[model samples]
Target chain A: MARAQELAMRDYVQEVSALTMRWVHRLRREKFSMLFTLVQPMLFWLIFFGSLFQRAANSEVMQAPNYMSFLAAGVVVMTVLNNGLSGGVDLLFDKENGFLERLLATPIHRSSVIISRFIFVMTITSLQILVILTVAYFFGVHPATGLLGIAVVLLIGMLFGIGLTALSMAMAFTVKSHGDFFSVLGFLSLPLIFLSSALVPLSAMPTWMSMLARFNPMTWTIDAVRPLILSGWSQALPRIGMVVMLLLVFDALCLYGSTRAFRRAIG
Target chain B: MGRTVAIETLKLAKAFGDVKAIEHLSFQVWEGEIFGLLGPNGAGKSTTLRILLTLLRPTAGHATVFGHDVVQEPDRVRRLIGYVPQERAIDRFLTGREHLLLLGSLYHLPKDETLRRIREILKLVDLEDRADHLAKTYSGGMKRKLDLACGLLPNPKVLFLDEPTLGLDVQSRLRIWDYIRRLKERGITVVMTTNYLDEADHLCDRLAIIDGGRIMALGSPAELKAGLGGDVVSLTVGAADMDRVESLAKSLKAVPSIRAISTKPSGIDIRVESPEKALPAILDAANQQACRLEFIEYHRPRLEDVFIAQTGHAIREEFPSGE
Candidate 1:
């Protein structure tokens, strides 16, 4: 029985890896799109846009050593958010192109598709996060809490992204077409970023905006990552624990919603 | 036929809210024979195929693939069957070989075995030369050939093809048909759904004509035509002369050996016991009425005739659209 169970587990793993490789192969084939993904988020935005706000956010009210250092944490978390929110687009395209229908007919665990989507989006997003940090490093941004803090920042980014990515997948299954999904992505991403402390300090923001940003998960993720980059562990550790707890609750809801959508679409 | 039963459905039914996609659907597909579900669009053919593939659950009744219940033992059923849906399911990003490799992994075949079968299937589909090219680079026919190669990856005991040749040019359709026949030769049970009368008549060993979520007629092509017990003599008349066309039909009803007559847009069809004796009287009637005959046609009864006789309408009612 144990051997049989192991075989079954191995089969499930094989199916998931195969499905995941399909997406990776797609990314590999679209060299221009991938190149665009890596270059667009780091070079233009970090150097140009970050410099625009560098001196403005260095005041005591902002409570940061410099704007470039502050925005590094935001950029890392934003990359994760960007990758996670649009992660559903590929699955939506697959649904439109009828590949999802075909996949369901094959002898595979249905969860494999969902799991593979999660792994693919997270891996790509994580790599993009690392790229954002490396590029920011050249710009004189470092994690004040050192190597361990860098790992924590990555962990927080991933934990924060899991729920949003799940929500994006749910949207993929819910929307009628890729056009509708893009609209949904646009509707959520920019608003969430603006409402968070990513671009401007919550202390410097207007009263109403700060009230709204208090509940935004992006703000939570950015705030947790910010200290690791500028203020180090004394200020970052407790925030990390609180952010992880809230994210767990958020991801559970998103996963439940996504599973329902997945079942509804395929069933 | 005293062959092994590969698939069976009893009182199967499915509904989407208030709309009934299929109901009271029952049939048996014998092993080693090509079976067909002949129906028009929305005739529940694809829905039935989906249920057998365990992609959808039936609202009522039971279906089994090689005695494995679709709902209760879906894993086993999936193991025994491979299904090609009515839509094109290829990814333009991947090459032909990549698609099969993915399928192999989904089926959990060993690495060396999958590699070996990929080579054999690529060759069988005549896609060995273009196996490395991206599917976006392949022609419509080549993509369809690759689709067929994917369905054959697991060497399934039963293959369900939903309108396998639904949207292909004549040569491509013919090539797909040839592949389907080859599968049957290898003792693989093929169950396809099509509205193309010629496809069903030419390829299927036995077929069930389904309409409005029900089977209207079920038999071999020859048997169904023979059951009509007559030859269908089609008399063509010009549309400009509608009055003469009705009078022609009215006069033909009095003739002996004529079983039935139905008037159509461009012509009238007469089901007679023998066209040999009925042609003289039909021509005599046309001549008496001075009905200018554009053409006259007679042949052994076709699946269309059987479909018309059973359903009281042409299967081509909606432009031969795919489900």
Candidate 2:
């Protein structure tokens, strides 16, 4: 029984990895789009948003030494949020074009496809976060916890991202067309971003809004990530643990929803 | 009598809200034969394929592929079959080779074995020369061939093709037909759906004509055509006095049966038996009715005649409009 279980687990891993490589190949082929999806938004935030807050760097309203440092974790988490929410577009295209049907017809474990998608989205988002952090480093903003803090930030982003990617995929399966998908994305993305601590810390928001932001996963992610960039391991680790627990619960719920959505769509 | 059944669906039915996509669709495909599900668009051919391939659950009844129940043991059924859908499923960004390799990997083919089979499949589909080109650069037929290559990558026991040649030109259609034949030669049981009567006649060893979510007729193409019996004499007449002309043609002695008479904007098609003996009488009747004859032809019974005989409607007339 143990041997059989081990073999099955090995097969599952192999299949998931193979499926993930398909997305990797596709990303490699559409190098321009991949680059644009990552670089363009980060650049917009860094230059446009960064310059707006530059004059208020050391102001009492700002919590960090500089606007760039204050905004770095926020931008990283925002990039992750953007990428994670839009990751399901690939699955939507596949479903629209009948590729999903072909994939589903194969004998491989069905969940591997979803797992591979999460891996793909997280991998791309991680790279984008790294690029943003590197640029911020050059601009005299550095993580207080240094390399270790950056790793923790990525972990927090990925944990938060898994649930978002899964939820996006569920929406992809639920909706009828790409138009409906984009409309929903357009309606939801800005609200989710603005309501969180992405552009501004939760403290800067109105009292009622701050209370709501406390319940937002993005807020939790940013709260956990911010101290690593501005303050150090002692300040970051406890929040990181809390956010990780929240993400675990979020991921479970989203995975359950998306799997049900997938089954319904295919059926 | 002991031939193995590759696939069997027993009283299978699927419904979407008020619409029944497939109703009581029961059929058996013997091992190593090319079977066709013949129907026009929206006739539930695709829905039936989806059920058999375990992509969709049937609302009632059961289907099995190689004795494994589709719903109960979908993974087992999936392992035994591959599906090439009507729409081109190839990623436009990937090369033909890359597509095959990806599919092979999904099938859990080993690295070396996958490479070997990719080469073999590329050759089998005659896509070796252009295998490295991105699929977006491929022509319609090339892309279809690539789709076929992906389906064949796993060496599945049964291959399901839904309208394998729906929109291809004549030459491309013939190429797909030949590839399907090769699949049969390799002893793969093929279940395909096509709206084209000639494609059904030329390729299917046995076929079931489905329309309005039910099987209207089922038999080998020759058997279905033979069921109609006798030849078909078609007379194209101007729209004037069509009802009178039809009644007159029905009165003729040589016309044992007025198989079908269809009215179009330009003309009316009248089918009768024994054209050689019936032509003069038909013409005489047309003249007496003051219906100007536009065209006339005689041909052996075809699958279209069988479809018409079974449903009292032309197969071509049922093609989904605006598609």
Candidate 3:
């Protein structure tokens, strides 16, 4: 029995790895797109938004050394959110071109296909986060928890990103076209990003808005990651633990929804 | 008939809401033979292939691949078959070699074994020289060949080619036909669906003719053609007298059977037995009725005539726009 289980696990790993490599090869071929995804967020946080709020750092309303330091964590998490939500475009194109049907006709476990999408999104999101951090460091913004905090921030981004990526995949299977997908993305992205503490801290927001941000998973992630970049481990560890638990629950729900949608679409 | 059954469907049915895609679809594909499902557009051929490939669930009844139930054991069914759908499924960014390697891994082949098979398939499909280039740069025919190469990577027991030559120039179509023949030589069972009668007649060892979700006829191409009798006699009458010409031809005793008498824009087509003998009688009858004979011709029966004889409508008429 144990031998059979081991063999099954090995097969699952092999299938996921193979499917994930398909997306990896695509990323390598479309280097311009990768460069754009990475650069767009840095351009916003470092150059545009950083200078916009540079003078606010000395005011009581902003409680950090510089706005860039405060906004750096937000930008990292935003990159994760943006990449995760748009990840389903690949699946959409696959469906339109009949590649998804070909993949479903194979003997590989169905969930492995979805898992590969998450792996691809998370991999790209990790690289984007690393680049953003490196750029922020040169501009005099450093993590209080140092290398360990950077690792924690990556974990937080991954946990949060997985749920969004799974949700996007579910939408990909359910929607009829890329137009519908773009509409849904346009409808949800700005609201989710703005409602969270990515741009402004919850304490600086209206009481009702702050309360609503508390329920947003993105808010939980940004709150955990912000202290790691702005303060030290003493202020960030508890919130980091809470965000991990919250993200686990979110991923479970999103994965369940996506798997169900996938089955229906393939059937 | 002595061969083992590779795929069997018993009263299989599928429906999309109120639209019945396939109903009571029952047929047996012999092992190591090239079997075809021939029909025009919207004739349930694709739906049947989808069910057999375990890509769709049957609305009623059952289908089995190598004795494994399609719905109950889809993974097992999938393991035994490789499907190349009508629509092209090539990713533009991935090179031909990468596509094969990716599918090979999905099939659970060992890394070294997959590489070996990829090399072999690239050669088999005559794509070795360009296998490392991005598929986006390949022509339509080359893309199709690459798709076929990917399907062959697993070396499945049964290969399903759904309209494998649907949209291709003559040379590419013939190349695919050669690949299907080679697949048969290796003892792999092939189940293909095509609306092209010539393709079905030349490539399939036996075929089932489907129309509107039902099988109208089933047999080898020769058997089906032979069933329509000996020869076809076509008469082109003046456009105004086409109906009179059809009625006159039907009145002849020498032309025992009127396989199909369809009105063309210019004249009428009349298929009958022993056209050499029937031709004179047909012309005499037309002359007796003073029906103008613009043209007349006689030829051996073909699969298209067989389809018209069985279904009472030409395959082209079924899909006028040529889907």
Candidate 4:
């Protein structure tokens, strides 16, 4: 029984931590990519795209102090969405290069592969969101909910990221090549972002567009996050419950799909 | 006589959808010996290795490692095995030491023991000096060494190497071959797959020559080659005529020292008891046949000859000489 218990400890927490650190170590060695991760959202999205509509987008319809502040939340969640979607690129490359086969042959809890991926993606996404929020503060957009609210905002982003990561991993296992995955990403990302309240308020979108955006998990997450940055819990609390419940269902469906995909692919 | 079996497959078969990868393959791996599966690219060598590693389930047979069923008890099977795949399996950004350290934990070695083992393994693979360097900085040979080091982190009882020396320079291939030879000294049973004739001939104590998902022959290299009767003297005739080759073969059969006669695409092969005494007689027969002799050569039987004797085709046909 003692030996049995020793074997039980063989794989979960230990394997996940080691694998997650492996991902972090890879990122650290690639200094150029790490530096770009910090600045890309601020440069491409907040500074340029946010500025395009800053003076034009009405503040009342956006439900924020200004369009840049409203777009700040959108950018954070967009970063999360992008990071989550690309989370499985490493695993796919591993598969193509034969590391995945090597990994699978080892005596590991196979689920640790997925768990480590989740931890790695979330950690990087958190760091990117922090940088984006810091840059937004420089643009005069402090969270109305302050320090505790920022934690809550990060938590909401993470909850939203979990579902996207699972779906992305499913795509990784299902698709034949990274080229196919990128094509799938192009097809999904822009339409989902444009249709949602990320760049424009849902209230301002065409009825047909709004109907589609209502079904997007991204829209639900952005709606929940937009208020936390612009208003306190009192305004954000009601939407938070609905979005959390919605995300739970969304994550369950994605998790189920990805579990099947993973089993089929690995087997 | 009380030898132990390390691995055994009982009429193992596997199919991917409609395509059969392995068919009724049966073999036993004796303990503490280097066993090789020799085959071409699509010959089910990797598939057999994968099934034994418990990475793939066989469609219609059973495989066991140390008496544990691979399909039913993979965790037990896995704990006893390590795999180095065809490619060098390393993350380019991770240092050699980092890869080993992570593998140490992944294999569930205790913290202090993992550190101790890492030190020992780095030294063993001669990576101690470059241990702190990222894998990308390493040469192709160095990357393969790091991969081998990681495979040893678990101290597995049986190690699976799929095409261990593949795609390496001759020097690097020799180095890896040296490493594999030493693995036997450490008493780790090795199961490797390779299509390279020299890799199998020099390294394996015994091997199975497989093709089209079936074993064509199985024995020690010496045993299999010795089964070819005797030395082979191949005469490459300049003509493309099969009838002329057959006629020459018929004429060559009359030579007193010749044991057997066979036809090749470009010439005739005569198995002789001894090439030296038969050389003059065979040359006389060739001279009488009045066919222009392109080239004539004789050598002790090689494993390739054994494969040809069993399967009627050269294994080297898969790879052109340039590759």
Candidate 5:
């Protein structure tokens, strides 16, 4: 019995790795998919911040040493979140195009397919964040917390991103249309991004809005990444612990929903 | 399970809401034989194939591929059989070579074997020349050939092809058929579905004709044709003169050996116990009616005649726009 269980575990790992290779192929094959993960978030950061707050670089209200630096951490973490959510759009496309049915017919573990998508989105989004941070570093964005801070930001960002990805995949299975998925995503994304500390200081916001931000996963993520991007790991340890705890809860909920949806789909 | 049958379904049935897609479908395919599921659109041929591949669960009963239950042991069945889905699931962004490699990995072929099979299967499907080009840039025939190559990559013991040449030109269709015959020569059991009567007749060693989610007939091409027990005589009358010809032919049907007469858009088609003995009377009637006879042809019964004899309608009529 023990031998059988060990064999099954090995099989699962093998299947997951095989699926990840295909996910990598899918990511590399489509030029637009890659650009959506990396460049889109940078563009959002440029247009929104450059327009709303022109003196962000010089204002003490920025609180951080450099305004762009403070905002860059938030943008980086947001990129990870959006990238994970947007990964499900590919699953939606697969269903519309009939590829999902084909994949389900194959002999791999069903959950391995979902796990591959998570790993693919996580790895690519992390790389994109690193690229943006490297560019910011060249432009005088200091790393007050250093490499440990950067790693903490990425770990929390990735976990939260995965939770969003699972939720999006659940939506893809339930809502067949790309337009419906986009509309629903739009409904949820903007409010979460704005209500959080992504754009400005939480102290400047009203009490009710601050309460919403505090309750938001994005808010915990920003608080975690901000200190890391500004002062390094020691300054962000307590916030990172809180973000990790919230991420675990969120990931559990999304994963449960996604697995249920997957079973329905295979039917 | 060892030699009695290579594939079998025990009273298999499935439904989608109120629509019964397949009803009590039970059949056995012998080892190393090309078994064809010949049917019109919505006749449950594709549905049966999907179930055998473990893509869908049976509502009742069960199926086995090489003695493994399709429902409970799908991974084992998958390891033994290669399935070419009805739709083109080939990733468009990847090259033909890349697609094969990815599928090979999924099938658990080792790295060296995967690379070797990719090269060999690419050549087998005549895709070697376009192996490096992105699949999105490939022609329809090329993409289909690549799809076939992926199915063949794992060197499966059995292969299932659903409408393998549904959208190909005549040349491409013949190419796929020729490769299929080669696969058969190598002793790979192939189960295929096609609406093309001629394809089923020419390619399948044994076939089942399905209509309205039921198997109306099943046999080899020769055996099925022989079951009709007569000859088919087709007369092409001018569109303007079909009415006179039909009336005359109907009047002659009472004569002995004149089995039946049917009117069609192109002309009048008749089935008789012996066309050689009955042709003179048909010609005589046409002459008496003063109807222009465009053409007359007589031949032994074929798969189409068998389908018509069983269903009382043309298989082509059942699939109005499938082609």
Candidate 6:
């Protein structure tokens, strides 16, 4: 029984860690792509939000005390969503090239595989978000909130990253091909980014679009994280709670779907 | 026999939809034996190996490596054996040393031990000089050698190679055969598959020929060939007067020791206990019938003849050469 347990530990720690390390190695080798994660959001923050905030550097139309400050928080959340969506493409490649089949042959803890992917994507996404936030601070988006708000920013970004990454991985399994996966990205991600108050105040959008934004996962992520970084850091629980609830639901669905896909692929 | 059977499969079976890949397949490889899973394409050779390695669940039945159940106790089985797939599974972006070190870690080798084993494996496969190069930049033979090195990193009790030299050039194939032989000499149990009869004949201590998800023949190379006859007298007859050639060869059936007469598209290939004794009678009968003989060749019976004896077609004809 002791030997059996030892073997099980090997499967969990060694096997799963190696699989995840591959993802880290892949990201490090293609370090150029991280530029897009940073530059893409920076471009939107400059053009769209820059024009809207030019008239009033500090006002209610910006929804916070400062417009650039409000928009910077939104930029960080969008960065997380982008990384999560692209990581799904990696899963599609595994399916197409039969690498997943090779991975299955080894005796490894199944959940470790997914959990490792979550950790890797979340790490890089948070780093890129930090870079964006630092740039915004240089441009005069000062935060009235304290250290607690900084922790909230990091926590919300990680939870959002894991949730969307799980959903994308689930898509990699259900979708017929890599092309199908990227097409879903094209159709779903951009609109979700735009619909949320990631670039503008929710009140600015028409009533119908505002209702959709309220339902959108991206909206919760931005709302939960923005207050912490901008000024209203005290009223944090409800928005953070909403983001947490949505993240848990998405994680459950994605983990369930990927496990099923794993079995099916092995068959 | 050194300790126990290194690998065993009992009534193992797998099916994909309506097509069976393996059916009630059973075999045993002793602790240090070089066992070959020889078969033509689609004969379920790789399927059987996959089952033994615990990669795919058997539709029915069970297999074990080093006395550990492959299905019920796969982690135990994985600890005892290494596997080299037909396609290279190494990360092309990683250096050869990195691939081996990572696999060694997965196998739970201590860090220092993992590095030591990586160096040793690279030396064994003669890949030490290319250890730092990315695997993608290596040629086919070099990549294959690195793959074998990865398999050996953990010092496994048994190794499974699925068509290790399938598409390799002649020199590379021979190099693989030599490495496999060296492994066997060190008392590592090996289970390998190949569609090439010569590969089995040259490298395997014992072989099993499978077809249509069943083992058609099994034995050592000499033993399988000896079962057919002492030699074969293969003759090519002109396309003209085919009936006359058949009738004339039939008339010589009175010859004392022609064990079997096999026919090929180009000629009648006959297996005889003694080629010299039967050749005169066969030739004289052809002369009497006025049938022209285009070619005649005689040699000791080969494993191809054994395959012919069992399956009514040469192995090459059954599994076509080239692709």
**Top candidate (TM-score):** 1
Off by over 4 Å in 3: A57-59, B239-250, B253-266, B318-323
In order of listing, the candidates' clash counts read 0, 0, 0, 0, 4, 0
State what share of the real interface contacts each candidate retains. 0.81, 0.83, 0.92, 0.78, 0.48, 0.31
Fill in the DockQ of model 6.
Answer: 0.45
Candidate 6: lDDT over CA atoms?
0.78
In model 4, pairs of residues that clash are none
TM-score of 3: 0.94
How does residue A185 of candidate 6 score in lDDT?
A: 89
Candidate 3 chain B: minimum summed lDDT over ten consecutive residues — where? B314-323
Tens-digit lDDT track of model 6 for B1-323: 24578887888899999989989788888887789988788889988988887778899987888778988887778778887878876676778887786676677677899888887788889999999888888999998898788778768889889899977998999899899999988889999999888888888988888888988888889999988767888888888866665676687677787877756666687778777788898898778888888889998887777876777566666455532
Query: Which candidate has the top score in DockQ?
Result: 3
Query: If scored against the real structure, what TM-score would every candidate get?
Result: 0.96, 0.92, 0.94, 0.94, 0.90, 0.90
DockQ, per model, reads: 0.78, 0.78, 0.87, 0.73, 0.54, 0.45
iRMS (Å) per candidate: 1.0, 1.0, 0.7, 1.1, 1.9, 2.2
Please say which candidate is ahead in lDDT: 4 or 5. 4
Q: What is candidate 2's CAPRI-style docking category based on DockQ?
A: medium
Give the per-residue lDDT digits (tens) of candidate 5, residues B142-212. Answer: 98898788778879888999999997888999999999999999889999999898899889999989888
* lDDT for B38 (candidate 2): 90
Q: Give chain B TM-scores in order.
A: 0.93, 0.87, 0.91, 0.93, 0.89, 0.94
Question: How would you encode candidate 3's per-residue C-alpha lDDT over B1-323 as one tens digit per residue?
Answer: 47799999999999999999999989999999999999988999999999999989999999999999999999999899988878889899999999898898889989999999988888899999999999999998999999898788888999999999988988999999999999999999999999998999899999999999999999999999888777776677777785675566456544555555655566666766566666777777788888988877777888888888788787876443331
RMSD of each: 2.1, 3.0, 2.4, 2.4, 3.2, 3.3
Tell me the tens digit of each residue's lDDT in model 1 across A71-143: 7777787788888888788888888887887788888999999899889888887777777788888988877
Candidate 5 interface RMSD, angstroms, 1 decimal:
1.9
How many Å off is the CA of B214 in candidate 2?
0.4
> Lowest-scoring 10 consecutive residues by lDDT in candidate 2 chain A?
A56-65
